[model samples]
Target chain A: MSSVTTTPVPRPATVARPTGRTAPVLRQLLLLALAVVVVAPFAWMVTTSLKDYADVYRPPYLWPQEFHVGNYGRAWDAAPFAGYYVNSLIMTGGILVGHVMLDTLAAYAFARLRFPLRNTLFLVLVATMLVPQFVTVLPAYDLVIRLGWYDSYAALIVPRMADVFGIVVLRAFMASIPAELDDAARLDGAGPWRSLWSVTLPLCRPALATVGMFSFLYAWNDFLWPLLVTSDDTHRTIQLGLSTFSSKYGTYPELLMAGTVTAAVPALVIFLFLQRAFIRGVASTGLK
Target chain B: MLAPTLVVIGVFVVYPIVGTGYLSLTSWDGFSEIKKWVGLGNYTRLFRDPAFLNSLWVTVLYGAGVCVAGVVSGLGIAVLLNGAFRGRGVYRAVFFLPVVTSSIAAATVWRYVFGDTGVLDAVLRFLHLPAPNWLGDPSLALVSLVLLTAWKSLGLNVVLYLTALQTLPADVYEAAAVDGASRWQQLRRITVPLLAPMTFFVVIEGLITSFQSFDLVYALTGGGPLGGTETLGFLTYREAFRLSHFGYGAAVAYTAFALVLGVTLIQWRLGGRERWSS
Candidate 1:
């Protein structure tokens, strides 16, 4: 039986040989050169972070003459990084939690629930994605002030909790799940919330992870909103705190580099752990 | 229930948007208790305002430059990295490092690199080339910002495109090779068409992100050298936050929002359907 299947296979055909061996070598060299160009700046950033103040000012040192490990410590001392870390953690966590719960629930409703204006509401939510965040900045600031959330965690956390992008992405994913599962659960006397919690949520882990990671990253790296809403150092997120360091002691390149590395560590850590999910999220949502 | 989510979005997101649209029609100092309806006065003023117009042009140029460079470089890097090579994983990680970093920190580092006595100038001088002060010169400041934006965003696009590239079937390349296709022909005929959806993804994303760019401009240029690098987002920030022209700021914000909305709608109409079908 195996010989019978194999007897009909066609033999391989000969293709034209390479005109020159140097072409592949040249291609490899070009690729490596491109890789170096792409990666050199980041290397420069890390090297500069380790250099002394004088070394930084010196002619474009590709590598540090001496590693100053103390720059990290000094940068920590130069700013309220501990406080910034706390604020950033709380803000990122709050936004992530709110997004996972609120968006998932809304996504569930949009995907499965029978209701009036369901399609209309989903379209409205998706339409909100086009409204650039800048358009709402001023009025949102005023609203925050009126609500007395200025310089408070509430201002930083609450306004961005239920994002339209999050809702749309989650809803799209949730819509792809089979409706029969929800029907089966409903037949078994499960309510909508219970059915979602029991049946739908487990299958939606990848989508949840994607949305959660994005929400966390956005909240972590956000600069303008935090800068506008929080004036006090205590409420400053990591991005704002790093900006403060730059404005206050930008002349101190070593210290600024140190602070920058510190500010960047968390996002890097998250990306390292969830890099695959993050990439998928970017591709699927078309967010860069 | 969905009610709470709807309410939050409505009050925090929807209401503010409506309020901004309303404020665009008025002229009021942020601190003043009075606001006068200005109708098309602000729009007319914006049209006549050379600084605003300069900012608009700079923004368009910056957005276009960054989008083109970012997508092309990102696609190239993604395809290069997608090949079978040792330590490819490590290269992927290294390339993605900048994407994970905070934009403020990235901008700060870039500011130093583009400073008057910085490494970039030193390199140019060493090569016997003219090195204009990048961020300091009005002519170069917006380009400098664009370069920084592309550099900072390169990692995200690479990772995004890499993910899309991995999804392409291996047999497609093998089939192309069997058809007597050279590497360049194979790439142009098979790879480029297959990557169209991802390209569209990157373009739309690049547009939205570039339109709302604020952090790098704020940190690097402060929209300076006579507002040479002032984008719509930064301009809105200045008018609302710095100058306390809250009403005017609100108007600028609405205009930017409208522009972004318009562009995105066109992109969706043109590209999105093909992408979805594919």
Candidate 2:
């Protein structure tokens, strides 16, 4: 059940291949071409975001003769994008802080602490992962409305504060640490809480980073839940804001591209910085 | 320590699921206090609803399209990048970029790319080809949606394939090579069969993702061009949120849940069979 291991398997010596000079070059060129194909739309996005309205509708829409960075500003002003940004940041921050703290404690208990029905409880938590988020959306919406959390930060944050995937990933990482550390901590007069904060946590930095990155990405980019709960701009997120913006200004590719680019920047920047953890962590978990 | 986590899950996840089940059995307009007992009426109407039936068919098409294309292309790219090479990390990151980007952003970019005089149309025009209305055509709209989904998901598929590819024992390939198997033959006979588990995993993952696909349809097509892209997930959104038919929406959502569960069970059995066959 501990499926979050990231260790690379040892490869046999026979796997090494003798390649001709042209073969490697060909492979590089081929992969490079494919990469261009993948990156071309993104490149188009950034360039189009800078183009004037006429250039966007122009034939062979490759390059812009002049750059209009004002599109970003106009797009920003065209909607309550600043409010959306603030709401998104606050929502993501709340979800991240609460989610990580709660999941860390739960995972620590599951991985280390001995308790009654621990296995049963952990299995119950893991089974929740199979229940698609949408399966609960209708009822969850009702629940939020009943609690009067709709169109508020509480609606956005509280429900998302507990994720089984985070717990599972963190638990697997914590379990892989040698149990001798806990005993050593006990010899030094440290309790479970002290040991968790001072010993186990320091060693689980990579896993924590991985979990944190995932939480950030999910909260930041989430569209459906936010859309369902927040009916107004006050609690609306960037993803929702961008959708509304696209619908209103459907014909304005320049402004639309600008808005989309603005919405995408935070996630892209975060991924740029933490991609090592992001990709590797995703590879390890593979379940989600 | 587990109290907070358990409470949140119990209230948010577990309770809502049970609540969704109960709500599916009653007809409740979202605002009304009175809940009318429908007793499978929504399910009956759902089966007879042409809109619901169309969405079901569209979802299957989109899921199958994304799964097949994503798996094949992802495997091809992963095999290409499997060899030790310069700048492998950069390539991997480039490929995985879309997987991390917001779905709305990806869909928006694709909406433009698929629009008339967009990037794809420009390219096709340059090559002296007619650019069909990719987004406005009833048949082509869903195809465009499928392509958009495939692009967004290609990265995950590649990464999954790469992870599986790395774990394959080189000794099997060595044995195949010793038996005078050609490079392509070695890949066909050894690499592919060994990666079947990942393929199955990816297929199931793809189906689930596609089945719940909403943001793409919402942003890309808006379930438009004659409702060609109205996936079950989108239909659920419309019935419940837009129309305020809470009960019917829950029924649609439950049907989706059942489909996903059914697929998983089938995959589980097939996986067991694969293990036995191996």
lDDT of 1 by residue, A79-189 (tens): 889999999999998988999889988888888888999999887887777677888777788889878898999998898888777777778888899989989999999
B1-278 in candidate 2: lDDT tens per residue?
88899999999999989988889999998879888998999999998999999999999999899889888989999998887656887888999889888999999999889988678987888799998989988779999998888888888888889988999998888888888999899889888888888888888888888888988899898898888999998998999889999999999999999999898889879873553233
The candidate that wins on lDDT is 2
The residue-level lDDT of candidate 2 at B6 comes to 95
Worst lDDT run of 10 residues, candidate 1 chain A, spans: A14-23
The candidates' DockQ values read: 0.50, 0.60
Give the alpha carbon lDDT tens digit for every residue of A1-288 in model 2: 476587777887654632412237878898999899888889889989999898887854667879999999999999999999999999999999987899999999999999999999999988888877778898888889999998999999999899898999999999899989988997899988899999998998888888888999999999999998999999899999999999899899999999999999999999888878788887888854
Instruction: Give fnat for candidates 1, 2 and onward, in order.
Output: 0.62, 0.68
Model 1, chain A: how large is the TM-score?
A: 0.89
Runs with alpha carbons beyond 4 Å of true place in candidate 1:
A1-28, B159-181, B186-198, B268-272, B276-278
What CAPRI-style quality would you assign to candidate 1? Answer: medium
